[model samples]
Target: MILKTILSGKHYQFKSVKDVMAKANEEKSGDTLAGIAAHNMQERVAAKVVLSQLTLNDVYEHPAVDYDHDEVTRMIIDDLDPLVFRQIKGWTFEQLREWLLATTTTNDIIHYLSQGLTSEMIAGVCKLMTNLDLITAAKKIINEKTANTTIGRPGTFSSRLQPNHPTDNLRGIMASTMEGLSMGIGDAVIGLNPVNDTVSGVTAILNTFNEFVTRWQVPTQTCVLAHVTTQMQAIEDGAPAGLIFQSIAGSQKANTAFGIDQHLIAQANQLGKQALQNKGQNVMYFETGQGSELSSDANFGADQVTMEARCYGFARHFDPFIVNTVVGFIGPEYLYDAKQVTRAGLEDHFMGKLSGLAMGCDVCYTNHMKADQNDIENLALLLANAGCTYIMGVPQADDVMLNYQSTGFQETATIRELLNLHPIPEFETWMEKIGISQNGRLTSKAGDASIFMEKESM
Candidate 1:
């Protein structure tokens, strides 16, 4: 029998998990692809099978699957981890919902799910929950997990200096870096999205960052955001590769457009790891967004949210130092307005955290988008409360090189102060030691300005 589901206004048909696996393999064959494909397929299959067996009364009255008591118990005992099974083996859906809501950390939830808590079980519990309950549960999970977890290096809140210039001029790059540093930013990593993707161009950018870091003795690392191949070449050419950067999308066509396939991505991860053995820093930086698959005309009928999740699964393979969802930068075709953009930001953060990624949100929009600073402000606050890892620190929320608006250094400060969040531990310590910041507040000293200006003159 064929089961049909509507996603992203498109109809998808599946005979079984086998059919889905076959299609996934035909498109892109890999362990990560197969794993995500199986999980999605099983979730859909379980939803149909479990929901069909339940009656309205059984759903509302007992808040449990409408199967025979013995059979349901047997399934739970057989599938779930012994600890989790003991907790919910004989419990109704109401009980399960209570337990899940009481669960604070995503790590524990992930462990349970990994131990075989099926998606059907989750769906059943969700059916009995109110929106408030779901939201509350989500908040608890994000807050607990993100508060304790550290990525790249240990820190509470981290941010990056994305100083890009269209012309790839050293002066322009130095100006942006100095501006960000003056504002006490760049804790996560100082990275540049190069206008030039070739080996020579990328090498120059990396060498420039290395020189700056060495001259000023900055605590943070730097990255020249180019294709993996170009980055590898720069490393071979004696340039510092502080981080390996790439843009990733969900579908094969989209990945190819970014000059990546699963094989290349794996190879890049391996290369980054090998290089970082001597440097002793986290090796990979990845950027992703919703609507990219559709933007590339390769979504393959999945909704933007699901496609984004699949990209996370793809990114997780590398255990990246940072995975940023460029939420509103994709434009209005997919996410039309502020509400959609805000929701996507929160959803991406939640999804990334659940998947064990060090997630950051680029609270940003474009000139053509139906969004503004207010939209970015609201989303940034929400992400902060959600325990987001980092944000993009551009100048005045405007990326001159990329032609997009994002959270600037001042905005990051506003959120940090509002939430009492600090930068990553090492960089924060450096900031304090250098007198650039004191008591978690930026000094914006006159001497620093003179220093940068003096360097610029030379």
Candidate 2:
């Protein structure tokens, strides 16, 4: 008797095939043991009965044995966990396959799988599915998980104020923000990628935005994209800590460079909860991308996709309000072209949503990439279909500060119009009140410039 062991995070050992069969039967019996026994018997008898009749190639190319639909169904029913079989017993294989392909909610698939399908079994079946079928199934899971575990208020579309500028130039920042606001954007939070990382620099940017809010009376929050430590200091110094922004990577060393770890993130979250006046508002904003671990030389031998998922896991611990994956921003070294960009965007969104993060996509690309505006547009639409929480609303799809072309105000309008999505409830009200957006239709007035300039002197 040969001992066979299956080791996972822990270990399970069986003294012999009979022991394994007995254990399986004890847990829940079906064809599992009987099928194995029969297969073993057939293998042993193959040499004696068919050895003289067939060549090596024929044996290798053909199945060991053929089973009709009834036989196959019987074998599956026997091996399946009793609960799973019961759930699926009434449906034929074709019907079951079709139902899985057509199902739009992940909860249904998860419910079925939980009935008794193992991960290995699921993966094996997935190998036979087309890419579209696989993506549809993944989207269902993401949708269900996102619906249940989202951080911020649920049931509304959100957008961020990514007003980036060189030198933290207030004029450029304000102009870009006004452009977005003119088109009725900036619902998530008005966040800035500061040129300076100092406490004073961050404080100045936050103060400028605070003054803007006071003067304009826009329903929004503010953030200066600095390290959490600096932002925390600004908060201590009485700056409005609307949202704490940080860039995160998969590995500890990479995160350390950003002055963050799980402990620091928790501390910052608590600080944000105390500092910000809004009750029940999510205050953490995290930025992650596909190649950040590899670019930081901290991948630790994992592939980029796995590393990206790990970053999402790290961000989820903080119950963040927003997690944006800067897809395609890292250039072609990581993700080569349009296809790579689209897949990475979908995968990142899917993984983040599954892990219960409020997932958004910066449907963007650098100038040096092999991709173009059409690629960005295609990716944006796909993400919208997948129910992405938000997207970067840069001016004319260009960010001078980051030197990348991302989704613009026009794309935002197009997406909303096409999908009939509205902004978050509060911002939607503000837009409707101000006549910028009415009844889900966005309109711009000629005096929009005067509104900002009239208050500029204040």
- Root-mean-square deviation of every model: 9.8, 13.9
**Lowest summed-lDDT stretch of 10 residues in model 1?**
25-34
TM-score of model number 1: 0.73
In model 1, residue pairs whose N, Cα or C atoms come closer than 3 Å (at least 3 residues apart or on different chains), thus clashing, are none
The candidate maximizing TM-score is 1
TM, every model: 0.73, 0.71
User: Which candidate has the highest lDDT of all?
Assistant: 1
lDDT of each: 0.64, 0.62
What's the lDDT of the predicted structure labeled candidate 1?
0.64
For residues 236-341, write the lDDT of model 1, one tens digit per residue.
7777767788998755667888878767777777777676422443477889887787767665544465557657656665667788999988787767778778
lDDT per residue (tens digit) for residues 122-208 in model 2: 322232334455456445543221211232343455677688987788788888887777677677777888888899988888888
